[model samples]
Target: SLSLSLYRAAMKGPGLFSDIGKKGRDLLEKDYNYDQKLTVSTRTASGLGLTTNAVKKGGLYVGDITTQFKYGETTIDVKVDTESKVTSTVTRAELFPCTKAMTTFKNSDLNYGKLEVQYFHDHASVTGAVTLKQPPNVDISGTLGSHGIVFGAEAGFDSVLGTFTKYNAGLSLKKSQTIVSLQLVDKGDMLRASYVHHLDGKQTSAAVGEITRK
Candidate 1:
């Protein structure tokens, strides 16, 4: 009955506690608000750079400007440079419904861009990403399980080189606070094995071994 009265009071204004109710509602609405920042740096003869950043609820936007204002030898020698980027991320219900997923998109004026999508449930997750540019690239990676045995792999293609520039796979076995991992890269051209054991709160022991192609 108390909560019902409070809800009714919050819904209807022009009362003694209406201002408190209005402030509470406003705070809840702006719970995930964002902020903006600006930074400026100048170096003798090097140039001056100003960076601006905005972090939204689930996204980030950045811009940069560089110019030689004080070091230019002549009026025609002065140069100004500018860069801008916008990145955003959405998760699960924010982008869609029901699915446990997250997606990120980023774009920059410097011919750089990226999109990544991931789906995670329980202790397993899968991620896929694409880079946009002259040499566009795509990568896929995933991990499974948290205890006992966990494994993940990542592979990518480089359009510029017309080859797979990224290739890595790893498996980890964990029990208690001890873990052993084996990883390979470049189709077995490189191999690494490591073991890590956690002692007390301030101590740990680890060993690593590696083998490389000749």
Candidate 2:
């Protein structure tokens, strides 16, 4: 009962496909940036936003500019870079109830584009993507259960090679102030486990640990 309440409180909106094991991943990998980065963002009254980010590390500078427009149930994002590469993504939500459709394009290589669709439900989520090339690669992932405890798996198929390129499965459990997760990735070639504990009620401070085996 307590877990259910906590799960409901933590769930703010529709879950994304990658949210399956995101908690553990974030606990182990987030907010540890060692590089210098700067970002400036602005939003207009007409549902348009522009953002530019630059990162400098070890005398290397990298930057990109992105623009986003939102209208009704659709959102479009475009990114431009100094390297003459342009990328765009269009997302439409509520295509049906809790379903969303997304398409991505790359100006440099049309074959690098992809189409993705996602469905999110209270107790489950599913996502599928396919590349635009003739012998496209496809990826599918699904998760089941609520935020308190969930099991998820993902697989990638290479149509040209007629083989599975990748597969991974993970499970995560969240309680009031603790999270534990286990993942088998790289087609079961590697295993990882993580634990996170909030030190305060505000969740601003936490202790996290992770272990991996290959």
Each model's TM-score?
A: 0.46, 0.81
TM-score: model 2 vs. ground truth: 0.81
The lDDT values for all models are 0.47, 0.75
lDDT tens per residue, model 1, 1-115 = 0000001111211211112112223333544544554556555544443333333333655444433332232111122223434443333332234333333344534455565
Off by over 4 Å in 2: 1-17, 58-60, 95-97
The TM-score of predicted model 1 comes to 0.46
**For model 2, how does the per-residue alpha-carbon lDDT over 68-157 read when each residue is reduced to its tens digit?**
999998889999986868888777766555455566677777445566655556787677777765777899988887748888899999
Locate the minimum summed-lDDT window of 10 residues in model 1.
1-10
TM-score winner among the candidates?
Answer: 2
lDDT of 2 at 14: 30
CA lDDT, candidate 2, residue 123: 82
Query: Looking at model 2, which ten-residue stretch has the lowest summed lDDT?
Result: 1-10
